[model samples]
Target: MVLETITRRRMIGISAAAAGMALLPLYGRAALEAVTWQGEAMGAQASLVIHHPDRAKAQGLVAATVAEVRRLERIFSLYREDSDLTRLNRQGFLVAPPKELVDILQQSRKVWALTGGAFDPTVQPLWEAYSRHFSTPGASETGPSAKIVGERLGRVGLDRLVCSPERIELPVRGAALTLNGIAQGYVTDRVVELLKAGGIERSMVDMGESRAIGSAPGGRPWRVGISDPLHAETVLKVLEVEDRAVATSSPYGFRFDSEGKFSHIIDPRSGATPQRHASVTVAAGQATIADAFSTAFNLMDTATVATVIGNSEGLEAYLLSHEGKWRHIPARTPVLVSKAL
Candidate 1:
């Protein structure tokens, strides 16, 4: 299974994944200006590209979008010392938590149930152990010992928290939360909402993942290139997206090992899923689900991938094996397609 590069381990030290985009100009039309913005948020590069008829209005909208993204960082970023997530980790409880935090936690619980615990936010402890173990000046090439991992694994599971509208509590001492796996996509969704609220439709939000708000200038689907996990500089497939989100997760994106064999995506159950895929890409209407499921799908086998995709209403996956072979759960995913050579 392909795993997300934004495992909780990423919050400790690993850099989050950065995505790429492509937009073509439409000939024989009015000036379909595409404005762009670039900056860093949640410890990685963020970009916004939009096509609009009114340049001034769209620029203002983009500015508002950047501010919105920064606001979300305060809610979800683990790097910030005062983020709600950081405060919860430090104090083990947060009373009167922000609504956004509560919303995300509720969604995480649903994903946890859907993926059979594979998409767990409580994997923070295990991620800490592995990330810290390998952060030493000259650490061992292996993962944390079975004993160390097992102790931390005891702390794994979202059920450790008592979540409610009044407050959320982590009863277990030292228990923490990590939304890295889904936060970026959540932020992208919010940005899309913000843009749409301002009358901007033809837009692309790339905050670690790509979300297409609407069709391109000429009513064509937005084209997104899926990078080769082992060699990110290359694009293995191009997906056409319209009012959908595209997310990719891989074992080789961020590795503690020099050979790029180990990614930080630890299976909260088994402690690890063998590196079996280059990456798994998911397309869905909600960026959060697309992000969370892509991470969890990396830990699943082919049969489970098929079952999960089939049962879900409008979700699809594109799997690229470690050996460079391509596979799809339904033999054909409706929202994503490979670009013909």
Candidate 2:
């Protein structure tokens, strides 16, 4: 089955997947306009919503956004089989990749190191192993299979991945990479840079949940509704953010029960679902860091998450535990609250 999850927190009214059309009202007069266009990317349905007042400016922003998406698709998409990432997977190493891909890989390695290996692209092999084993009868219910999978996951280490400025090589044959944790955020950062360069100041572009930028019109921060942890249709809180990126990592979005046991949000470190936190939302100055840290924090224990957020300079976080309480770190003191609150 195609696993689906909402990994970010941004409010663009939901539209039917067919034809990629959203039903939200488009602002026409306020020197700000919003439009949603859907296309296939990263092996899934991708949407782009650009909001700006100048029609010409908005069009340019959309063009730049599309170009950024296409560029990332070429570098990170595993579905293409011919993508740079896919080629590396098939060949065990790639020589002389595009500069953009090289840059992202280098950045990913840095994040991997910073997170103490909690966030890793090399966990693709572990995901495949768990998915295959979980699909078999009795395997999901048995602890033995899970133990076996976890043991095998020990081999999926970031240290096994070697990257130079010109090339990347995986030491193990089965090691694969998935940019799902950071690619969208990187794309979002690029789109924001393009919009700024094009002189369009206020806009929001969402690539799934990992990237969103800009604010609404009239000098107001873009208002986003966070989905209820218990119910996807309900809003638990509203956040007003501007010129920043927000990402939500939650197991509630995509989960499945096998023989009365629940599993979702696979921990790359353990090849199993993490049991500590129910959901985490991170807002950072950059989308790539925000996206990567959300997953990294999710895999971390409560104390580590607290330590990371407490010491982080520009990162603000909202976390919900499995016990149904909300906690925040590095309190902004007088926090901004939405009307719904």
Cα distance off (Å), candidate 1, residue 238 = 0.7
Off by over 4 Å in 2: 1-57, 137-140, 143-147, 210-214, 256-264, 331-341
Which regions of candidate 1 fall more than 4 Å away from where they truly are?
1-36, 49-56, 137-139, 331-341
lDDT of 2: 0.64
Residue-wise lDDT of candidate 2 within 1-341, one digit each (tens)? Answer: 11111224433211111111122333222223554566665445665555444556656666666777788888888778778999988888989877777777777877777777888888777666656666667664543365667666865887777788777888776778888778877877776677667655445556654333343444455655667766777767666766667777776655555442344456777676665678877777777887888777778876777777666557777777888777765433333422223
Q: What would the TM-score be for candidate 1 when compared with the true structure?
A: 0.85
lDDT of each: 0.71, 0.64
Listed in order, each prediction's TM-score against the native is 0.85, 0.81
Best TM-score goes to which candidate?
1
Q: What RMSD does model 2 have?
A: 6.4
- Candidate 1 clashing pairs, residues 3+ apart or interchain: 1-298, 2-298
- For model 2 the local lDDT of residue 181 reads 79
Tell me the tens digit of each residue's lDDT in model 1 across 66-138.
7877788888888899788899888888889889899999999988988889999888888888788778778
Model 2 alpha-carbon miss at residue 245, Å: 0.7
Steric collisions counted per model: 2, 5
Cα RMSDs, all models: 6.7, 6.4
Error of 2 at 208 (Å): 1.6
